[model samples]
Target: EAAVTQSPRNKVAVTGGKVTLSCNQTNNHNNMYWYRQDTGHGLRLIHYSYGAGSTEKGDIPDGYKASRPSQENFSLILELATPSQTSVYFCASGDTGGANSDYTFGSGTRLLVI
Candidate 1:
């Protein structure tokens, strides 16, 4: 089964601070994604990578960046945090196939910025 997990499940950051959220996957899948979930906006993709050493911007890449250094790991970086960035972030991994192959999501990382 594909499984993704994220560290620092909850975080509180000050304005203009830097925050890094880490994700690890055991599935060894070639596709991984970072997304943020908001009440009205649903889940919006922030970044994704096809494999190691590649990162691509997603629907809502603003104010966020991603890194995939290896098959099992990915990181989301917030260079200058702000209150608007407070939300639940999720890490997911899946095959290259379409919707037929669903992505597995981490529990989530709830970040609160002040």
Candidate 2:
């Protein structure tokens, strides 16, 4: 079975501090994405990777960094956390090659920046 797992399910960060949210997949998917869920706006893409050693800027990449060290692992990094960055972040792995994309998502990491 394919699965995506995220660590530190909940986190509290002080303003200006750094935070890293991690995700791992067992499905060996080549593409991964990081997104944040906010009130009224729905999910916004922060970053994504086509595969290992490649990272791409998504719709909302200003405050986020993404790393794909290997096919199974991807991480989202916040260099300077801020209150506005507080939201639930999700990591997903899948390919959008065609009409049906089989994406496996992590439960999510809830972040609160004060």
Candidate 3:
């Protein structure tokens, strides 16, 4: 199995609350990504990191933040949770330099804003 794990598999918070989703990947991949899965937009990237201490904005970065503290850990933070932000967030790790850069996903974290 892929050595990736996500914390707090489910969460519920009041509007304007803060929510943090954590992930740990033991695969040692150079690239880590945070994505939110929604109804029609599909899986949209929220943020990504190439390595430790590096984070880059993704296609849909508004209202989202990411942190890569080390090669094995990445965190997704929602400073102000809103109902519109409720969705399933997934963390994936991959090394794009290889011939076949396949990603391994952590168990998604489902968040609900009330």
Candidate 4:
């Protein structure tokens, strides 16, 4: 079966350091998304891409960057990690056909910046 996988399920980074979270999908979905879940706030989109070589800024892309070098891979980068960035990040792959289209999500990556 197809799946979405994320690396380094958990990570601890120092403030001002750089962190890169990666995602890989076997579902062949054309759309990939990156989101972060915080305590008070719900899941917020950080960045996304429609396909290879196309990355778009999402609702909350201030402190994050995204790269889609290939159709099956996407990466989220934190150039300057900070405490406020500590959260559970999720990666998802989906189709753009319709609203009912299925979306496969990775387990999630828990990041802590101290």
Candidate 5:
């Protein structure tokens, strides 16, 4: 079965720090994505990848970076974490590029910065 898994289901960080969110995708899905959900912003895409060795920045990539090492792995990194960056992050895998990308998501990682 194709599935996405994110680690450190919850996190807490100081004002200026670094946070690394890890994701693993199984089931040979060609497209994977990272999204953050916040109250006012709704849900915004942060990063995505087509396949192994390919990572692309999404709409709001200012404070984020992504890495795709293999067909089954992707990671989102916040080089300098801030309080405003605190939110629930999700990892998803799917068959993409069509009209609608059928995505299956991981539980989520909730991050809180102080």
Candidate 6:
């Protein structure tokens, strides 16, 4: 089964501060993604990578960046944190079959900006 895990279950950040959220996967899948979940909105993709050393912007990549240094690790970087960016972030991994394939998501990282 594909498994994804994220660090710092909860975080509080000051405005304009930088924050890095880490994710690790055990399934060795080629696709990894970062998404933020907010009330009244569906999970919006922030970034994704097909494999290590490759990161592509997603639907909501404005305040975020991503890095994938290896098959098992991916990180989301918030260069300038803001209250608007405060939300639950989830990391996911899945097969390359697109929508037909189910993605396994992490527990989520709740970020609170002050």
Candidate lDDT (C-alpha), each:
0.94, 0.93, 0.93, 0.95, 0.91, 0.93
lDDT-best of 1 and 3: 1
Task: Give per-residue lDDT, candidate 1, residue 56.
Answer: 98
Instruction: Give TM-scores for every candidate, taking all chains together and pairing residue i with residue i.
Output: 0.95, 0.96, 0.95, 0.96, 0.93, 0.94
Q: Which run of 10 residues does model 3 get worst, by summed lDDT? A: 96-105
lDDT (Cα, tens digit) per residue for candidate 5, span 4-85:
8899899998877999999998868888899999988877999999999998988898999999999999899998999999
How does model 3 fare in lDDT? 0.93
Clashes of each: 0, 0, 0, 0, 0, 0
Model 3 C-alpha RMSD to native: 1.2
Best by lDDT: 4
Quote model 1's TM-score: 0.95
Instruction: Output the worst ten-in-a-row residue range by lDDT, candidate 2.
Output: 95-104
Report the Cα lDDT for candidate 4.
0.95
Model 2, 1-114: lDDT tens digits are 779999889999999999999999998788999999998999899999989999999999998898999999999999999999999999999976775566788999999999
How many pairs in model 4 have backbone atoms within 3 A of each other, for residues 3 or more apart or on separate chains, i.e. clashes?
0
For 1-114, candidate 3 gives per-residue lDDT tens digits of 558899989999999989999999989799999999999888999999999999999999999999999999999999999999989999999997667578889989999999
The TM-score between candidate 3 and the true structure equals 0.95
Span of 10 residues, lowest total lDDT, candidate 4: 96-105
Positional deviation of residue 77's Cα in model 3 after best superposition, in angstroms: 0.5
| Model 4 per-residue lDDT tens digits across residues 1-114 | 999999889999999999999999999999999999988888899999999999999999998999999999999999999999999999999999688466789999999999
Model 6 residue runs over 4 Å out of place are 98-100
The true-versus-predicted C-alpha distance at residue 103 of model 2, in Å, is 1.4
Question: How big is the RMSD of model 4?
Answer: 1.0
